[model samples]
Target chain A: MTGQVRTVDGRVAGRRGQETRQKLLDCLREMLSTSPYRDVKVIDVARMAGTSPATFYQYFPDVEGAVLEIAEEMAKDSDTLKELVAGKSWAGKSGPTTSEELVDGFLAFWRKNDAILRVVTLGAAEGDKRFFKIRMTVLNSVAKPLAEAVKELQAKGQADKSLDPNAVSGALVSLLASAAEHQKAFTSWGVKVKDLKPNLAPLVYLGVTGKKAPK
Target chain B: MTGQVRTVDGRVAGRRGQETRQKLLDCLREMLSTSPYRDVKVIDVARMAGTSPATFYQYFPDVEGAVLEIAEEMAKDSDTLKELVAGKSWAGKSGPTTSEELVDGFLAFWRKNDAILRVVTLGAAEGDKRFFKIRMTVLNSVAKPLAEAVKELQAKGQADKSLDPNAVSGALVSLLASAAEHQKAFTSWGVKVKDLKPNLAPLVYLGVTGKKAPK
Candidate 1:
């Protein structure tokens, strides 16, 4: 279980203090989604939350700190993504279906948390270790298990033996992450929004099983 | 032709003026590489460029404007990426060679311009149309021709007919982009830096040709 929620000044938050803290986080989340990260400020977040900047600072050190908190929460929720691959069958017709569900599940998780995820991605790309670790947690939620699946199939001679399961699964997950992040790019390329899943799922199936999805 | 280089105030930049503008941009580029985009300021860029904020404004309306300029320059440079796939042979053993070269070329371009591309990606993800368009120009530089190659292979019965050429190529390019952006992530996954190309090239080959890369 998570330890007690504490203010930056080291005071434990009571129920009322916790509600205020959550409200500040929710408001900061909205601010991030609507405005550029560079433009998001503590005063603005405090204003939106109907609290003082002093109160905002009491609970969090800064905007980036609060965003990391939000990212950490989302990373925790990302644990559910494990089910999209864990103990799942990748046999026969089940393979393509598994890929589709994984794609759907992953994309949905990304879309839901895109605002904070964007900041985390930017932070990680900028070489912030905390954000990088959080990103890994989310990606590995699916990737680690998916890589295991690839290894299992390869062991059984159901997949290509030459491929590195970690690389294949990592590439597949990276592909999914990129596709989810830039879905609009596909639209401009003449692929429909609905066409994405149908196309991506097969590629995932192919990448994992090293065979074209059965028609 | 790129037409006349002009200042934000609508004055044409002469040779000397262009040099100053370029210096400012170069300095801003350095600032972006070393600092967080959110924390990068016009004043800091101006200071680093040994110029006044007013002079910096003479060349660019703002930091984002200058960044867009840098991204535009990189987009123009992206034309070279087309050669990686434009007229390359993807037949038999040549298929894997083409894939490896494409991976190498694309990754090199990304690594060289990772700083600017990071801002562009963040801007695009945040729904900025200008940044999105530039990112597209860079990506489409490869995705378009790669798709055409896939189409040709599909037509010749060398690739899976059921898969969409555009989708397959787009996904592959997306994978490369993601992989390039997060090469560090792959390294952390027990994948060595040297292992990326050998691993990714085959995935590209597999995705495009619908078969494992021939040993």
Candidate 2:
């Protein structure tokens, strides 16, 4: 992450600047906690964070920029998860066990960050410019390794040769994304992440392997 | 199509009524002519229509309502197209054939009333209670048949049976939606719909079928 810019007053680079920046983010997350992304406004964010309107402009260009920064950080976290999912193969009789690991890793992450992700998801589900666009980037990044994994599986004849593993790879990424979104939105309020896994894991498996497992 | 509600003199109804309603829609369209859904607003709409605030509300409840009424019509067009496509067999065929009919129908409608849709889309893309919730009704109405079409295609052994047709179906809907929003935002600058078809068709096909025809 880039360091907070300073005016060299040496008073922690000015109380206003440090407070405003963190305040904006604090407000952004708080607003997101209550509602979706499109509903939050720059003025509203400024007020919630206990900062002034002018101070908001000093820190970010517009609501989009402010939201973009927060979304970007969440995106980095999403990428780390995507990386974990994309690089491995699913375990069959003779192949590596990436699929099971992928499932367990994803569910665990989803359970852990369920709240923040619920807040950040407005970007994806709402089609916010800063929201959906970032996901498109993450998906493109995840696509390459996933394609490689699929190709390897196909070459080993561990997966269905008739299907395009590459396409399935991207589809798997989408499946997990939509599933997580669905879980957050529809899973009974206060439903724990542990409750999510039993349904989601099988659903994810079906997406990747095209098999109706014993769910 | 629902005919315009008329007054005692055979004009559009009370307050600023029919003529005013038409003007508001026309104004909203003009505002979107150069800008995008993401950049325009109710005040701009009222300004362009040359109407007062009270007059704007007489015809609809809010800004989104003004634009949403028209989008409801566009979504109806989508449904008619859905019926037409479902009447055919679209299994395993995720090439130029399936996408052309689907994309072309939306584009044709999109061409005739790009402005209203641009504004209506602003709500449809967001998840606002007053805005997006109504949009979702139209979305589900449109997506339902497409979902049925995929299920039918899978049952008929026309599409990829091994894949989850519902997941693929939802993916296709998201693809079209993503393209619509993208085209609305990007094309506001000057891109032609006809020029877009060739490339966009293939991309959405890939999104749906998750396969590319030997690029």
How many Å off is the CA of A95 in candidate 1? Answer: 1.2
Give all TM-scores, in the order shown.
Answer: 0.98, 0.64
For candidate 2, report its TM-score: 0.64
Model 2 C-alpha lDDT per residue in residues B85-157, reported as the tens digit of each score: 5655444453457677776765565456555544444443334444444444444544566667666656665
Q: Report the poorest 10 consecutive residues by lDDT, candidate 1 chain B.
A: B206-215
Q: Alpha-carbon error at A79 in model 1, in Å?
A: 0.2
DockQ (model 1, Cα): 0.87
* Predicted candidate 1 versus true structure: per-residue lDDT over B1-215, tens digit per residue: 77999888899999999988999999999998999898899999889878899999898888899999999999999999999999999997888899999999999999999999999999999999999999999999999999999999989999888878999899999999999999999989999988999989988998999887777
- Residue-wise C-alpha lDDT for candidate 2, range A60-135, written one tens digit per residue: 7777677677767766776676666554555553122455556566656555555355444433443456555665
| Alpha-carbon deviation at A28 in model 2, angstroms | 2.0
Per-residue error at B27 for model 1, in Å?
Answer: 0.3
- Residue B212 displacement (Å), model 2: 13
